[model samples]
Target: MQQAPTVLHVGWMSRAVDALVRSGAEVTCAVKPADAPAARTVCARTIVVPDPTRSTDVLAGLARAGLAADAFDAVCSGLEFCLLDAAAIAGDQAGVSRALAMRDKFVQKRGVRDAGVRTADCAVLDETGAAATALPSFPQVLKPLDGGGARNTFLVADERELTAALGQPEFTAGGGPWLLEEYIPGVEFQVDGFVEGGELRLMSISRYVQNLIEVHSGGLVAHIVLPPRTHPELYAKVRALAETAFKALGHHDGVFHLEVFQHAEDGEIVFGECGARVGGGRTDEVVERAFGVRLHDVWARLATGRPSGVTSSPGHADDKVFGGMNLSARPGPVRAVPSAGEVLDRPGVVYAEVSAGPGTVLPDTTEATNLRAGLAVVSGADEREVEDRMRRLADWFAAQVAQETSDTAG
Candidate 1:
């Protein structure tokens, strides 16, 4: 019998590795040295590659001739920012149609728009002065074209706010390519699905609740999975909208995470953006536990040219809720140690992660704390019950921290 094909993943250790392993495939990772230690713990073997972010030309050169082609079956990338060049390389080496179409923000949005999907009114702000002058009405958003995880995203409430926000260090992270878009106020939703041979399969929908204002505030994400039993119409709409998007993007044979916005008052759904792979931040875990669908396995299966085992059960999709909350440390000196153990014990919480230990200094940035700190995933049979569990878990963590005070003795 032929041995299981070796899959070459050109990035760090991630949920994708675990998925590949579950599909009975031997996985070899190519990642940066900084991520080597963690990669070793997860994969059977690892190859240290130069940081994928540094230079696209260097990566292309390595891919064109330097890397050994006899070692792997296929090339794959998981994250949004890492896809373009890696996909280009993998596609070149494996002779696959892996040339990615999602790296350019304008192109990505344009593709979605051309697919006849509804999206925010966005324009590439090439002329910085003119772009800055033509800021949309209050509550508009500014972000880098090829950005993700809320990185380089800015929200402005008014003219003054918009100007001040544009001046922030975060706004320039995009380097040059940037966009300004009209913000849509509404309930945020996320869809993680796959497209095969131009066919779209809906996996899960998550309703994101932000503890702080704005869509890109780097605040906590309190969410619940949907196909809402109490509101079947809403669930169907969300699912259909996502299907339309998948069809629009012309995405085939891989996972895609698309975010949408539903106007709170009018219920108008607006397309946000889509990641061409599995949803990050333990979203895969939540979807599997809540929906009984193994997306990681499905993605791996599809990646290896096999049938994806994906289906919905008897109940409505939103009948059960599952999602995660991102945590962050308030800016200040550590006054007391925070115990994450209490959060781990909360009902419905499958796991809790805390990256910032006691005395670790953290600075505010456009970076979302998806993995910077830690996340807690909660799943339950009902939305209220699930949200309640998450709130309880959040409260536990909140209570553990004590701010440093000048009046008190050290």
Candidate 2:
């Protein structure tokens, strides 16, 4: 009998752990103390650490747990913040460099651009609040060097807006070394897939309903998966760009979530950024439903150095379109909201998770797209139908929700 591979998974991803267990791997999870309870449920062992994204903390926790570095066949993380730590603990030098490049937007863009890929002109703003190089054009984007979920990201139209935005605490208090890039005017899209041995294994593309930065100003954060059969030319162009960017960034193996832009006028593809993990916001569910690929399971297999066992099924290449949305609400004291069961009962709604209910104080939506009132996945016969369903769902949910007014606030 063969022994199952042992995996050291960092962070607390319930789905990743479950997939690893289902793959017959002996999984041990390292997570923050607060997540230990949930980690304990799916993993054979759980090492509670103060911070799972810190390699030192994770290594020390593993030592305290009596688990040697060599005991595991792989070290992996599904969280963007923990990717570098996982790679470092795994002792994979190449993987560490790849993680670093992916985590730091400045490094990533420099490398990709040097490799002859078209990317936004960018400069690094160091601790002194000064750009390493001259600033880009008037319309520029400012974001954390290692940020995700579009948090602390800003689009400034001019010097006034830039100055005002920079005054925010996130830029002033120890948040040095930000990335300022020329704003690319185009329709944004995301490509999700797995790569192995420096080769593109599988890929899927989805067009965003609105640019993520717009989410800070009350725009909907939603997207519909584009079927390969329907958008062959688009898939080809995006795949070409993604393959080039992935190779340039040295992302040899792992699941990747890449964002790119299609030039609004010239239709040229421009690389935005990439992550060494699955895309967030119901991406895994939408991809599986549209392409018949379970990304979590694929991640597990790739992390364990096993074949991905993922193959595009021609049968799934029908006209059926799938989409996902991060339900949003205005900042206020929530009065009433629908339950997950109620949302699931709606036609065309395949998956629903209602995170906010009555009494939940919804914070300002400017923080991140992940800070949602709820999330839902819908399916339709085509893109138009899926989009309509998404709008209807959003409107219906908003109408059902009531926020407490000043007079009602006791």
Q: Write the per-residue lDDT of candidate 1 for residues 60-133, one digit (tens) a residue.
A: 43465456534467666565555655555554633222334445556666777787777777777775655656
Best-matching candidate per TM-score: 2
Candidate 2, superposed: residue stretches over 4 Å from native: 1-3, 128-133, 311-316, 406-410
Put down candidate 2 lDDT per residue, 108-171, tens digits, no spaces: 9998899888999988777534642348467888888777778988888887788888888887
CA RMSD of each candidate after superposition: 3.8, 2.1
Candidate 2, residue 166: the lDDT equals 84
TM-score of each: 0.84, 0.94
Task: Give the best candidate by lDDT.
Answer: 2
Poorly placed runs, candidate 1 (over 4 Å): 1-3, 41-45, 54-66, 69-71, 92-100, 133-139, 171-174, 211-219, 311-320, 332-341, 362-372, 402-410
Compared with the true structure, all predictions reach lDDT values of 0.65, 0.85
Against the true structure, candidate 1 has what lDDT?
0.65
